[model samples]
Target chain A: MVEITIISGKGGTGKTSLTAAFAHLASNHVICDLDVDAPDLHLILKPENEYLEEFFSGHEAIIDQNLCSSCGECLERCKYNAIKETPEGLMVDLLACEGCKVCVHFCPVGAIEFPMRRCGQWYLSKTRFGPLVHAQLFPGEENSGLLVSLLRKQARGMAEKENYNLILSDGAPGIGCPVISSLSGTDLAVAVTEPTPSGSHDLERVVNLCEHFKIPVGVIINKFDINLDQVKKIENFCQDHGLSLVGKLPYDHAFTEAMVQAKTITEYQSGDLAEEIGRIWARIEALAQLKKAA
Target chain B: MIIALASGKGGTGKTTVCASLVRIWDKPVQAVDLDVEEPNLALYLKPELSGRLISEMEIPVSDQEKCTACGACSEICQFKAITVLGEYLLTFPEMCHGCGGCLAVCPEGALSLGARELGEVLWGQAGEIDFLMGRLRVGEAMSPPLMRDVKKRLDSSRDVIIDAPPGTSCPAINAVKDADVIVLVTEPTPFGFYDLKLAREAFTPIGKPMGVVMNRTGFGDAGAYDYCRATGLPILLEIPYDRRVAEKYSQGEVIADALPEFRGRFIELAARIRELAAGDLKEVSNG
Candidate 1:
């Protein structure tokens, strides 16, 4: 099977749109959205829920106030500053707690209880395109990287069970935890970026991260016509770094218009932009094939 | 007052709004780039960095000599960063959360503290603005620690504008949690509106007054506006979808610097934020 993950270091650079378009064009594939915290692909794909599972990871400390001796040992030993002496007596701030279990171990009275935190939920769903695996991490929750990994594993299992040949995933923004987990084992990491300076800078960082993980990378400059000069600079950088310049898409408003209707650009219209996306997908498929052969 | 410009989605103009606000503010203010993973505020602000410090976190390291194969350290570690095999102990520093639980649990006193490089904290000046930012080390999974490092330089005496990372997750929360007020910059689209609701839900518990700045106003629908009205998140500013602004932003030019008209709008935005913050504070005092 060939696995390709679409990622952009900077947010709002059309990763989900392009991934959805690719999913529409590709056959015998499973789609996955790894942007758990702020997922947008579901809005476009409109997946129908098939199975839902709660994701529990890590632990949070809860003080049993009734059994507490009020010794303040948990507060002093807690490095995260999560335990606070509030008006209702000592309390644990759920947001601040790192779930290290230090309080539970160090409490002389054993008043601290460490319980698994329900971080979020993952879903298996069916879209018009194919099977999809997605997740939603609770707001302000951590462990997004772990959640991404879990989704990717589920996607792989789905693809293998159905004998599918491809797995297309939309990754989170930034060169951080979730992005890392999404791109690590993929066959090709497609870095979708814009011609702007922020996009260029972030693309470089994310590409560097892909290189660190030894994953092959292909660059796609969306909205290339916005600034021709910036596009040229990005092209030169790609050449110098020996990265593949997969494709360049012009500035288009159909992306937003189609999104307004909850449709992928390809499904919304058969215009030049959709055609260009098809061509880009062709190029990415060629690269994926090449990687597989090697 | 500390004003944080954040978004539920990436590339929603958090840095753009932050850079412009710092330019039009009438007084010397601190501009902090809390998006350490992909910091872009310095690109627009052009800060001449005056100081740099390496940000590091402590992880436990074990000495083999005094180590008994007891599994207390591994048992207490919630992150599974450390594992004790039959005769050897393995440590994965990247997975470590630096909570020091392993060290505290080791009865043989074989574990010691070792510093792991997180990133770099830089402080400088962008004309009259005091600039500070953090750059996370490449491949580093954690960001909240580095964000905390950058926030250590926050000059509370001066007005602060924080450019927060996008999303409604832990890193975004860590950046804006302490701000007196938050300006959620979002485009007017389905994706933008959906994530805006999530961001609002995430940040509401912080109890800080927040408003919305509608960007790319001409395009997309009114979902964001309707949601804002229903939730009482005042619409603070509406930057139209102008090609000139896009071009200037593409070139890394601050909108307030390149366009005369935007300077007035940004100045007005700063004023409106101040009034909102003051009003919230007054209500808090009365309550």
Candidate 2:
């Protein structure tokens, strides 16, 4: 099976919109949104839930005030500064705790309890386009990378069970944990970027990350018409780096309008934009086939 | 006062608004780019580097000579970063959370702490604004530690504007924490509204005053505005979707710099933020 993940190093670069469009274009595929924190593909795809599972990862330290002598050992040993000296008493900020269990181990009076943290939830759902696996990491929760890995594994299992040939994933922004989890083991990492300095800078960073994992990467400069000069610069960079310039999409309002209507670009309007996305999909398919043959 | 600009979604003009605010502030403002993964504020402000510091996180290293095959270290590690493989103990530095838990639990005094270079913080100046940005190492996964390092340079004596990372996660929280005012930048679209709601929920617990800056005002629907009004988030600024703004932003020029007329607008925006932060307006009932 071919698994292609769409990613942007910078946020709000149209990763979800493109994924939704790809979901509408591709067949025999399972869609996955690996952006566990603040996932937006579900906003567009409107997946109906088949099942929901709570995701528990890592641990958080709870200070038992009654059982406690305020020895301050946990505070001194915590690398995260999670244990804070509050006016009421010693408190642990769950968000700041890395669940390292140092506080639990170092507590002098056994006042600290390290319990599994219910970070978020993952969902198996059915969209009009295909089966989808998505997740939501609780606000201020870490371990998004683990959650992304779980969703990808579930997507792979479902695809294998149903004999699907493709897995299309919408990745989170940044070159961090969730992005790494999404990019690793993918057949092709499609780096969607724009024609801006930060766009090019971040794209290069993310593509380099993909290269670190020896993943073949292709670039699609969204809104290339925004700045023709930057487009040329990006094109040269892609050529020099041996990356494929998959497609150049113009700055079209239809993408946002489609998002407003909760529809894909292809489903909302059939014009140059849709045709352009189709062409991009064709290129990705060709590359995936080439990789499979090799 | 420290004014933080953030967005639930990416590319919503947090950097754009921040760069403009620094330009029009007319005072020595400290512009902090806390979006360590993609520090873009320097691109617009054109800051000249004055100094740099390598931001590092501590990871545990096991000394094999002093090590016994006892699994106490591995057992206490909640991250499972260490595994006792029969005669050898394997420590995955990448998976380590930098908590030094294994070191604390090692009875044989075998484990020692080592530094892993996560990223760097660049401090410089663009005009009157003291520009500070945190750039994470390309392959590093964690960012909150680096974010704290960047925030440590906050010069509270001057006005501070922090450009926060996108999304409503821990890193974003680290950037937005302890700010006097948070200005959430968002476009007028469903994706924008959905993520903005998540961003609001994320920061609401901080109990800091917040407002919205509606970017790309003419694009998409008015759902973001409805959210702002229904949720009692004051609209601090509304930047109309202008081709010139996009062109200038693409060229790495702040809106106030490229178009002199927008300086007044940004200046007004900074004033409004101060007013909200000072509790003078008190129009919006904040969380």
Task: Give RMSD to native, each candidate.
Answer: 2.5, 1.8
Best by lDDT: 1
Q: How much of the true contact map at the interface does candidate 1 reproduce, as a fraction?
A: 0.90
Chain A TM-score vs. truth, each candidate: 0.99, 0.98
- DockQ for each of the predicted structures, in order? 0.84, 0.82
Q: Write the per-residue lDDT of candidate 2 for residues A1-294, one digit (tens) a residue.
A: 999999989876787889899999999999999887779888888999999999999788899999778888888998888888998799998878887888887787888888889988899999999999998888888789889899999999999999999999998789998899888889998989999989999999998999899998889999888899999999999999899999999888898888888999999999888999999999998998898889
lDDT value, residue A98 of candidate 1: 93
- Give candidate 1's chain B TM-score: 0.96
lDDT of each: 0.91, 0.88
Residue pairs of candidate 2 with colliding backbone atoms: A11-B10, A12-B10
Docking class of 2: high
Interface RMSD per candidate: 0.8, 1.1
